[model samples]
Target: MSRTTFTLDDLKRILLEGSGVPEGADLRADILDTDFTDIGYDSLALLETASRVEREYGIELDETVLGDATTPRAFVDAVGAHLSAQPV
Candidate 1:
């Protein structure tokens, strides 16, 4: 039950690399703790990000958890939890 540790930078990268985020919208470090809506992410973008995470980590994340994630840390935590629960 080892969870793959993902950094904030990794989350940012996923957001940037994945589609739906406003083009050229800078995801500054200061905004990691900010709400996704405040940071300019729409629901579709979040869903896309979740899809990418699931595909990248090969884990099925809870949609409810992902939908409720307002900050990058929350998303990271949810993903980490899912990863940790995975069979080794």
Candidate 2:
């Protein structure tokens, strides 16, 4: 089974598991539009998150798209797009 859509909750879980949430970084808040950097996740953390997502979802993410996704919303949207394109 595979995911057909990417959600904020999914990103939150992967972030927490792949790279523990930083102290004071509230994943409980509405952080979809917040930049990952602003939420204590650096480029490295995002990379790790992307890796986890790729392995878990069995999909290869476009690095250029990932690089352009600065916020959770953008990241989620990017993943959702890929997921949507996958063969069902």
Candidate 3:
């Protein structure tokens, strides 16, 4: 399988949908308003979201990038970087 390019909006949509947030939710606001330690996402939820992203973009995310993702913005940014670095 080959990776498809994704824009920031595309990545946000994937993340929002995977995270069970409404399509119209303000991603920036959502991230900014959350407390990472108490964000309520279980390990399974994070794994699910990460797997969804990997499936959607056809890329296996690096563990280093995954480890740094402590917030929604971090997730978005890391996924965006992966998308950008993927083969054309």
What lDDT score belongs to each candidate, Candidate 1 first?
A: 0.77, 0.90, 0.64
- The order of the candidates by lDDT, greatest first, is 2, 1, 3
lDDT by residue (1-88, candidate 2, tens digit) is: 3677779999999999989989899999999899899999988899999999998898999988668999999999999999999988
Q: What is the lDDT of candidate 2?
A: 0.90
**lDDT, candidate 1, at 5:** 68
Candidate 2 worst ten-residue window by lDDT:
1-10
Name the top TM-score candidate: 2
Each candidate: how many clashes? 0, 0, 0
Clashes of 3: 0
- For candidate 3, list the clashing residue pairs, or say none: none
lDDT value for model 3: 0.64
Instruction: Give the number of the best model, judged by lDDT.
Output: 2
Tens digits of per-residue lDDT, candidate 1, 1-88, equal 2237666777888888886356556676577678887777878888988888888888887768766788887888888888888877
User: What order do candidates take by TM-score, descending?
Assistant: 2, 1, 3
Off by over 4 Å in 1: 1-3, 20-25
